[model samples]
Target: MRTPLPKDKCVAAAPLCQSDGEIAIIAEFLPRRIELTRADPGCISFEVKPTGDPRVWDVCECFQDAGSFELHQGRVASSEWGRATAGITRSYSVAGL
Candidate 1:
């Protein structure tokens, strides 16, 4: 069996938006999600922050590679917690740091 080589993954930073009602739910979920993901095998870091705009928020995450990020995305997509939030908007970029 061939051992898989570790790949470098770029950091991603995104800005998110949600309705007022969803904010509370998102707030509760965000920290838990960060804590859980940060402990995952391939995760480097996961952080969530409130933006200056009331309905907008920011998320920064780092992973070992695209594969690891895809895994994380799958986990979040499957989360019932993620489904509850409506009117979400996201913009992602390759983080320099």
Candidate 2:
């Protein structure tokens, strides 16, 4: 089996919908999603922030390495929360800290 790698810091930003219900849904699911990721050895930090605009959400995440990052991405993409927010545009970046 492959040993889990260390965590790497990262950030993600996305353009959310303008609907209040959609924003509520995102708020409800984001905490659970972050909690789930935090339990993984490869996860360092996971956070979600709402921009002043009603149509933007920012997500910051830290993973151990490329492999761990990919794994986390897969999990996030397959999550119900992800599916619910599929309409949004997502952008991600890795940090060296």
Find the candidate with the highest TM-score and give its number.
2
Give one digit per residue, the lDDT tens place, for model 1 in 1-97.
2223333334555535455666667776766777778876667667677778766766667776657667877877777555755346667776323
TM values, all candidates: 0.70, 0.72
- Candidate 2 is scored at a TM of 0.72
Query: What does candidate 1 score on TM?
Result: 0.70
Candidate 2 Cα deviation (angstroms), residue 39: 1.7
Flag regions of model 1 displaced more than 4 Å.
1-15, 94-97
- Tell me the tens digit of each residue's lDDT in model 2 across 1-97: 4443334446556755668877777777777877888886677677777788866877677666667777877887898867877776566565653
Superposed by TM-score, candidate 1 places the C-alpha of residue 38 at a distance from the truth, in angstroms, of 1.0
The lDDT, on a scale of 0 to 1, for candidate 1 is: 0.63
